[model samples]
Target: MVFILDTVMCIVTTMPQTKVPLSKRERTARRLTLCLMTEEKQRRPRPSVPYGPTAKTVAEGVQKMRKRRQLTIYELSALLKKAGRPITPSAIAKIERGERRVDVDDLMALTTALGVSPAALLLPLKDSPHQSIEITGAGEVPADVAWEWASNERSLPLSSGDASEAELGYQLHSLPPGRRYLRSRPVGRAVEALRRDVDRVVEISQRSQSRHPSEFADRLAAARLSLGRLEAELARMEAEREEFDRSSREELERLRQEAARLVEEQSRGGGDDGAGVD
Candidate 1:
């Protein structure tokens, strides 16, 4: 009986144990663990924001301006070349494709080439869907005026004439703020008319020498008076324009100084107490 028992024990010990299947709860727990690991991976933080204007904004602005002007990339490159800052068509293509960032100098050149303001490139498009309140000449308004207008346009509305001028022409250093540029066509017409009048007077004055001394004197006096009046008008317009420009510049300077002071104050507030430094 002892031998038989030992034989049975040996057989049981030597036999391989049957493999057990995992329980439903165990399998579910393993699946949940894998899902939690995946969720943790998904919760990791993204990279830092890009500096300067976003690539997409710049690219869209460039392409939009180019198309609006009906220009090829090569043509735009040529225009920049003429402006003393040469850029290749491939470079323009890279910019339009959002593969490159534009430098300040390049941006100025691009605006000049495209005949648009720097704001046209730097500012978000105002005419986008569901956000189409007209910015009109908002891009060209002085920085302080822009801030005011943005905050409350009804309280400080932009003059329509000033806005129209801003949209049509750029400001000139030599002229008043809003009335800086006189349309060339009108000026040219005036000049041509003046030339014709001068020529006619010269012809009549020469003929008067042989005809009537009194008539000649009268004609000459009238011409001199007219010329003097024209000169006086021009001088008065010039003085007024200069005065206007001077005031505008002073205002702009004041705004700039105020902005600088505000920025300094903000910086100081955000920085360390500077107790350790000189």
Candidate 2:
């Protein structure tokens, strides 16, 4: 059952110019949240395949590569030509459109031209299940929208790494465990991933608290409260799924009983006619 969110998924359009300075992990989380929130809230149609988060993430990646390289489409075309691949500006546009998939060599060319590491181009533009899509946004980017985009951004990534896994712990800070007033689904992959990250963070917090019990007590309490919030959301989603499953089962049972009754009535009528024949 594919349900369309009539509401537009417009969360993070223009990145914030200035906000709190974030650690590397926090920045990833903030970006993820901002991106995913947009996806969730902004469901507007786009002229691209892999529409929705996948398309948006790819477009964003292309844009990022171009920006990092400090090159316009024309410049990128020139660079590629000089490099011997001879990619056209039209082709660059097509790649950005998510119509054409670029190879690692293409990625390297863009990265080198942009003067950034290949890793920079490959930073999980899409928030994946493996990495936390922690994003932060202000300036009227609705919280619901931000959550959706950040949470689903991971589903958009076309590409991964040990480094990606290592950053997972820090990346989780910006994500919402559940949407406002709605419990995340029991099998909700996003919710489950959040839980896994929480568990890891909680372990770290516990060790820290143990080593400096008095100093970290306040922080530990705060973490516990957050866990409570997430658990509540998860519990609610679980209940909804259970209720839906029960209703489905009941409907099946009713149909079965109706069929059985019809069969019995036919058998009885057949017996009555047989008696007359005998």
Model 1 spans > 4 angstroms off: 1-55, 127-278
Clash pairs of candidate 1?
Answer: none
lDDT of 2 by residue, 60-117 (tens): 6777778765678899889878877777899888877767766778877766666666
Error of 2 at 26 (Å): 73
* Residue-wise C-alpha lDDT for candidate 1, range 1-278, written one tens digit per residue: 85446544544444223365667666555555555554556677765445343455667889999999999999999999999999899999988887677888999999999998776776455521123232343424443333323332212244565664553443333335433334233443244335434544575565556766665566567666666655666777788899999999999999999999999998886675564463
Give the lowest summed-lDDT range of ten residues in model 2: 1-10
Best by the lDDT measure? 1
* Backbone atom clashes (below 3 Å) for every candidate: 0, 25
What's the lDDT for all of these models? 0.63, 0.58
